[model samples]
Target: MTATRAPQGQEETRAGLWARLGDRLIVGGATVGDHGRDGEIVGLHHGDGTPPYDVRWSDTGRVTLVFPGPDARVQHFAPHAGPSAVRQS
Candidate 1:
């Protein structure tokens, strides 16, 4: 998986990025070693899978945007699959 970022690491996100609905967002990329946040893509602000995705956090059930950041990456799982298996992108 590649990291998307604004030019010079600015806090801007470009539109048209593809994100599947229900995909998981893994924060910290294992650098935090299992303590990072885990969230699911619940909705999209844009229909075309753009940034600022609506994410429902697993640990807290808090819904928030999966904003552009260096510490986050997306993990996609097969449809109807159980939580035991996770397909990372």
Candidate 2:
């Protein structure tokens, strides 16, 4: 899965970036040996897939609100991305 990320050492995120339900989030670890963590975007607090997303972690199955940092990347696969895809908050 391809991801649009800032330059190798750059910290800023690409413009117009957002996520939705069913999207996969991969967060990089501090070191290369660490595989880091991944999760599914199960809830959208603003219904717009903005920050502070409710994520269900694949490793722990724990759901938590996430504010993605520079180390985090999202892989979206929302075919029907629009009003119908948004859930009532």
Top candidate by TM-score: 2
- Report the number of the highest-lDDT candidate: 2
Q: Mind giving the per-residue lDDT tens digits that candidate 2 earns over 1-89?
A: 99777665343544754786777889998897999999988888776557878888989999998998989988765444533465678
Per-model TM values vs. the true structure: 0.58, 0.67
The lDDT of each candidate is 0.69, 0.77
lDDT tens string, model 1, 1-89? 99865675232444434465777877764654567888888888877666788988899999986675776777655555434455467
Worst 10 residues of 1 by lDDT: 9-18
lDDT, candidate 2, at 16: 54
lDDT of 2: 0.77
Per-residue lDDT of 51 in model 1:
75
